[model samples]
Target chain A: MRGTMLYAPFDIRFQELPDPVILEPTDAIIRTVATCVCGSDLWSYRGITPFTEPHPMGHEYVGVVEEIGADVTGIQPGQFVIGSFATSDNTCPNCRNGAQSRCIHGNFMSTCQATSIRIPLADGTLVPTPDQPSPGLIPSLLTLSDVMGTGWYAAVAAQVVRGGTAVVVGDGAVGLCGVLAARELGASRIIAMSRHEARQKLALEFGATDIVSERGDDGVEAVRELTKGIGADSVLECVGTAESMKQAVRCTRAGGSLGYVGVPHGVELNGEQLFRALIGVRGGPAPVRRFLPDLITRVLEGRINPGKVFDMTLPLDQVAEAYAAMDQRRAIKVLLQP
Target chain B: MRGTMLYAPFDIRFQELPDPVILEPTDAIIRTVATCVCGSDLWSYRGITPFTEPHPMGHEYVGVVEEIGADVTGIQPGQFVIGSFATSDNTCPNCRNGAQSRCIHGNFMSTCQATSIRIPLADGTLVPTPDQPSPGLIPSLLTLSDVMGTGWYAAVAAQVVRGGTAVVVGDGAVGLCGVLAARELGASRIIAMSRHEARQKLALEFGATDIVSERGDDGVEAVRELTKGIGADSVLECVGTAESMKQAVRCTRAGGSLGYVGVPHGVELNGEQLFRALIGVRGGPAPVRRFLPDLITRVLEGRINPGKVFDMTLPLDQVAEAYAAMDQRRAIKVLLQP
Candidate 1:
């Protein structure tokens, strides 16, 4: 099988890799249906998140089970399923509490940007579609594995509820999906802070009632203005930069909640000012598995098509072009069909 | 009536301030039976929090209602009561949602520390005690007005529960009380991170199962070791410093909650890193009024005496000494009597 591997900065390549197998009774092998490049992958791609030898390079995927371990209880071969960017034993205390991403034995999925892959704790990590999803819904279903699920968790963590105001910072795929999730969670007002016209339109389509085409201080002011000078009732910080985080806090009301799902870069949380500001801050690596099932349903029901975030698509062999599109900001998320 | 006034960093004076009267239709006048300096007050005295011209400083008090406005409905004159540090109308959405400290028209009562003080929104702010409280319970009951209530809120915000482990990251009255609060909340293991013998002893007496004398990184390690390499299920951050906040975040389990009530000092929140960290953070100024009624009952019934935090007592005239002792770290909290 061939998979994407990165040996160093700007060194991504698709090369032959050993085929995967069921290493344990709880492991299962899946033939990749669709995979996508994530914004987080770019960090390591740029060599900021350092590494060693070439390693498997993807974490998001939707596919049909090619083989199932004997211990796998709920899933079988040929069943379409959406698995999270990370694997979790859903029975753990943390997993049971809706924090599957932080489960005691949580494992990052072996990069799924390959023809074939092995998933551990298959019964706990994979959620099968009630029925085989049609090929047209493949891309949308694949998104529920990571970006879409993450956006949903951001909305939930921020506690955005019916009739409340929700603000999302960052124009990435996660942010756009957050706009949809906030609306689905019943937020009466959804504000998307973005600059790209295409992204803005998508945000609006996904339920953003307002848009702030500014960043940093100006962005905070713009959000406050839209919120009647009180700031947003909930803020989803989807960009990991320090500036974006600061903007997230500044744009939230005194007692509002800030749900953050960004892969932080150069961010520093100072305790004193944050405590005085009085906003509750939550969110870590999202429990994507927690939302995958419901998100898949939403995709199947045609309530949303989050895969529209992938403006460009390519064959698995065109992985390099996919990376370039996302890196250059020409695309939000680039999908690959294996 | 005489009251203690903070004139400068080190200058506190006893002055014959004007007698307080019911200034608003919802206000009442109370004759204080007991009053004490708050942990926040010492911040100014220690030159950490800025000093303003003649800041009338006390915020914690328990007393008998001397008079009530015609419209005051829930409370009446002659009632023994304890109120929150910040008075709330308790009718706004914020208050209705249990965040009384952020009430729409809330007022901090630190400015009215005199023997006779006017309580705003008296019907909503004050909590009734029995007609008579045992003399021995006065100190503890007085604590319910702020310190104990604040501590309890911290514990509650941290989500402490039965069969769980908790860590308190401050040694002030609030943090010490958090140890008591954690126990009362049914936390199975209570860890008080304190180096001071006085506070440490009090923590143990208040049900702390262990004490970590270290701070920051070392302290986090100790807590992890105690919790079998995982961390406390909850962490109560009661100190406003950056270091303490970091410890609160560091000592919590991956999915555990950190409830904080520390007045933030220069702290900044990094959304990205925090998103990857083990804990979830929530909390702000304690809604003491919301918890005071129940705490006052416990105090009156001899269930707790959190006022042991006031190690020294002084006449109103010794206001300078009272501030000096607490500011210099010689006392936990100072009791000022008229």
Candidate 2:
């Protein structure tokens, strides 16, 4: 089977890798219908996160079940499914609490961007939408796999109250979607911190009421001024950069909450400051599995169009171009049709 | 008026000071009926926390309202009240949300140790018992002012779950009461780290399931081991020392919550570690005013007896020895009568 293999630093190759097979009783093989590149993927692509092992890349995907293990339940062949980057046993205590991504049995799904992929914990991790989704719904449903769920986690973790202000720190797809999420959660105001016009415009479309084109303390101050000196009641930090995390922390009002979903690089928390202000901080990789069902319904209902974050789309043969475009800022997110 | 004042390190003197009057429209002059030394006072008495300015020192008090300003509503003169150290309006958003300590108009009682003290925000800050309590209930009621509230805040902040493990990282009155708070919050397992005999015994009575004599990482490892390889679901960090903070962080489970009410002397948060672990940290000075009503109800109903933390008592003239005994670790918590 032809697949994308990450060999080493700045190295990705289109090579013939053996097709994935069901090695466990809960495993199932799915033919990838759609796969995409993620910002976290860019970390390794930029060589900042060095890969020591040669492995198949990509974790986000929408697909059709091709085969299933004898014990695989609920998920059947010919079903269209979307799964999170991480696989989880949906029945674990953590999973039952709507944090499947932190399920005690949660593990990284193998290379999902490929002609065929194997998934474990099929019943618990995968959400099968309708047998067929409208062409208009593909983009939005695609976003549910990772970006949308990640954004929703940020908004939820921040405890974004209805009729309250929320600040989003990051211009990435997750950040923009966080704006949409804050709005969905009933936040009356959403502030996006970004200078780029394209990103800012998308943020506005997603539901941001204000934009602070500043960084660090200045960004915090701008948000504070906009929120009438009380600062944001909730802040969603989607940019994994340290500076964005700092801004997120500084921009939250005393006794407010900060929901950070970005894969933090070097962000530091000043305990004294957080303690004195009484602000709460909570976040992690999105528990996409927990959110996939409602998101799928909302997307199918055409209530949300989060797929707009995918500015560029390509086929399997042009996967390299998709990576390059996203890495060079030519695209916000790249979708690959396999 | 004769009142207690701390001139400097090891110098708590009873001297003549101005009789507190209603300085604000909402102010009330409370005749100090019962006041107590706090664990935090030891920090000042031992000079670990320097007295930047000379002032009265006690913040834990249950008093009789001697007089009230004309504008002070809800509270009448001659009522016995058990109020928090910090007075709050209780009508602001923060106060309404059960964070009265962070009320917009609240003030920390940094200098409330005297015999006759003025209280601001009289309406929202003071809660009167159904009837003036007997002497035995006075000490227990006084604990509601700070230490008890701090412990309750820690437990609540930690999100202690029923039939789940909780690690308490301090052994002061607040820490011991945190063990109680965790129990009240339904934590099935409470592990208190302490070497002191009295506090540890009280912690057990308060429902601490285990005790860790070790400090720092060793204590954290012990907690993790007790939780069957995962750390505690909730951790109540009552001490603000850097060591306690580290233990608090280290002992919490991944995706777990830490309720830290410790007043950090000088502490920092490692954002990189915190973000990756997805730990939730929340706390500040206990919203004592918010919890006062409920705490008073519990004490009146005999559901909780927090006065056990106070092992020694002295008259107002002997307040100096009260501070000295607490500083020398000869008492868990001390009570002073005026």
Candidate 3:
């Protein structure tokens, strides 16, 4: 099997690797149907998130089951399926609470960039589509494995409600999906913060009702101006930097909620500031498995087109180019055919 | 008029001060019916929160309207009322959103220990009782001004629901009140973390089904054990120190909620930890005004008895002793009468 690995900063390699097989009774091997690079992948590739040694990359994929462990009964070979970036048994206390990302028996999927991958907790992790999806729906269905699911969790965590106003603070693929999620959740007004023309256009298409290009304090002022000085009822912090988190907090009105899905990299929140603002904050790795079923339905039914976030697509063998394009800001996201 | 002044650390003095008079059209001067020493007052009293000059002390009070400015319409002179420690216009965006403590036209009351207090936004800040209460009910009604209301807010913020499990992290007056609040909200298992025998007894009386005398890591472990190793569904953080906040977070289950009502001092939260835990946190000064009406009804009907938290009583002139008792931990809370 072939797979992508991160050798060093700015270094990605597409090389032959050992084939995956069922290692446990609850494991299954899947032949990758489609896979993609993620914004988080850039964290290690840029040396921002240091790594001591090279490792397999990618956590998003749509695949067809190739083999199943003896104990896996809910799914079978030849079935098309999707799973969360984080694998969960789905019956643990945390999973039952809708926090599958924190499931005691769960681990994040990191080798999905390979042509074939082994999935643990197979019966609990993967959800099969109604049927083998057509090629046109593959990209959108692939998103359900991570980005789209994360965006849905963000809107849910922010408590976005019908007639409420929403502010999305990042313009990346996940942020764009968040705009769609907020709209689907019935947020009456959606504000997309971005300075990029192309992303802004996509945000508008995803249901953003307003756009504020300014950053920092100026950006907060713009949101306030648009909200009658009340700020937004719900703000999604998709960028995990200290600046973005602070801006998101300031953009939320008192008694409003903030849902942050960005993996933090030195974000320290002041207890005093949050207290004074009376903002409810909930964030973390999204429990993607919790939303996978509904999101898959949404995509197959053509209610959403999150695949539009994939501005570029390439053969799986050109995985290096996909990473480079996204790193250089030449592509919002790249869908790779396996 | 006479008032309590904190000239410096450990120097609370009851002395003559200028009488408060209405300075705004929406202001009302109230003669002190009752006021009390708060745990927070000790922050400045202990020099932990410094003051540049001697200032009138106290923010909790149940008073009778003595005079009203020309524009004050809803409240009348001689009416007995209870206002939040933080006054709000109630009509402001934040107040309308149920966060009156962050009202656009709001200010924290600081001179309520004096004979008279000029309450800004009188019509919005003060809630009149159904009628003048008997002396026996005064203490319970007085708690609606701060401590009890704060406890109610903590439970409310933590999203306490029927059959949910709740953990109270402090055993102070507010924490004891939180036990009651959790019970009122229908939590099936209410755990109060405290080592103080007196406080534990009071907590049990307030409907705490369990008491964990341990602190720090052991305390979290105990809560986990009580909660089937999943931690409590809702945690009330009544102590503002970093340690207490951290303990509260650790005691909450993944996807559970925490409401911290403590006025934080030097507390900084690592975003990464909170994110990983998926613990939703919301805290601030309690918007007591928002709960005043319901709490008043509870007290009037004898459904709650939060005033029991005030174990000691003192004449207004003995304000210095009241502070000493609370500071020495000799009294859970002290009620002062004018």
Candidate 4:
């Protein structure tokens, strides 16, 4: 199997690797149908996150089951499926509570941007599509594995109440999807904080009612002004930088909730500030599996087009180009067809 | 008028002070019906929190309106009312959203442990009782000013679902009130963390189904064991210390919510830990005004007895003793007749 590996910062390569096979009764091997580069991937690609040794790349994928373990149930070979970035038994107390990402036996889906891979806890982690999706739907189905679900989780965590205003910080793929999720959740007004034209356009298409082309305190002021000085009722923080977090917290109205899914980087929340803000804070890794069924239903029903986030798509051999495009901000996301 | 003043750590005195008079058109002067020592008061009284000047010592009180400013409309002279420890306009964005403590025009109700105190934003901050209550109801009504309401806020913030399990840290008066609040909110099983015999007894009486005397890691393990290793569905963090906060977070199941009403002291949360735990954290100064009306009705109907927390009482002139009793933990709470 040809897999993507990050040997060092900016040193991504496609190399031959052994094909994955079921190692446990709960595992299944799947042939990758689609995969993509994530914003967080850039953290390592840009050397911001230390990459000590060669590491397998990609955790998000839409795949077709190639073989199933003896104990696996509900999923079978030849079925198109969506699996979360992390594998979970889905029956643990945490998984049952809709926090599969924190599952006791959870493991990251490593080396997944390849032709084939083994998924542990197949029965609990994989959700099959109604049928083999068309190529057009593959890109969107791939997103359901992580980005889309993350945005949905963000909206839910933020308590984006129906008929309320929702502000999404960060114009990355996740943030764009948040606008869509906020809209799907019935936020009457969606505010996207973006300075980039392409991302801003995508955000508007994804249901952003307003776009504030500013950052930091200025951005907070812009959001406050939009909501008549009260700030948004719900805020989705897609960027985990300290500044973005501060902006997210500041732009939320008193008692409003903020869902942060960007994975905090150097973010330190002052207790006094949070106490005074009285904001309800809830977010972490997206429990993508929890929202899969509903989101899959929505996608199949033609209610949303989350796949629009994939601005570029390349053949499996062009994995390096996919990484470069996203690395240089040339693409919001790059879908890889394997 | 006479009020309790903290001259220094462990140095409390009943000092003569000028009688409060309306200083704003929205102000009302209330003659103290009942006042009590709060757990937070010990922060300064024990010198854990610095006491620089001779500060007026009380904030919690239930009283009768003795005089009102021209603009005060909802409250009238001679009306028994429940006023939050902090005054708020209640019409501001924050107050309208149920965070009256963060109201744009909010102000702490200082110098309240006196014969009379002035309350600003009277119409918005005061909730009149159905009628003048019996002397027995005064203590419970006094709790509405802070502690009881704070506990109620904690439960609400934790989103205690009907028939869910609730774990409360900190067995002080507020935590005891949280047990009562959890029961009122329909939690089927309430766990109270307490080592003190008196606090444990009060907790059981207030509807705690279990008590865990262990603190820190052991306490978390105890809660986990009680919940069949899943942890509590809702946890109330009533103590602001770092250890208490950590225990509260650790004892909560993934996806469970925690409401921390204790003003955080020496508490710093690592984003990674919280993110991995995937617990929802929300709290601050309780928006007591929001819950005032409901709590008042419950107290008036003989449905609850939050006043039972007051195990001792002292005359206004014995203010020093009132502070001493609470400071020494000799009394769960001490009510003052002013």
Could you give the DockQ of candidate 4?
0.73
Clashing pairs in 3: none
**How well does each candidate reproduce the native contacts, as fnat?**
0.63, 0.62, 0.92, 0.70
Top candidate (DockQ): 3
Docking class of 4: medium
lDDT of 1 by residue, A69-118 (tens): 88998898989888988899899877876778887888887579999989
Per-residue lDDT of candidate 2, residues B1-338 (tens digit)? 77777878998888888888888888888998888888777788777887687778888888999999888888777888988888889898677666687788888885556688888888888888777898889888989998888899899889898887899998999998899889988898899999877778889998999999888777877887888776888999998887788889899887789999878877787776776667889978888887888888888888999888889988887889988898888998888888
Model 1: docking quality category: acceptable
Model 3 CAPRI rating = high
**Who wins the lDDT comparison?**
3
lDDT per model, in order? Answer: 0.85, 0.85, 0.94, 0.90
Which lDDT value does model 4 have at B135?
Answer: 90
| Error in Å for residue A200 of model 1 | 3.4
True contacts kept of 1: 0.63
lDDT for B223 in candidate 4 is: 92
Q: Which consecutive 10 residues in model 4 chain A have the weakest lDDT in total? A: A268-277
Per-residue lDDT of candidate 4, residues B250-294 (tens digit):
988988999998889987766666777777888889999999999
When only chain A is evaluated, what TM-score does every model earn?
Answer: 0.98, 0.97, 0.99, 0.99
For each candidate in turn, the TM-score is 0.87, 0.93, 0.98, 0.98
Model 1 CA lDDT for position A251: 88
Whole-model alpha-carbon lDDT for candidate 3: 0.94
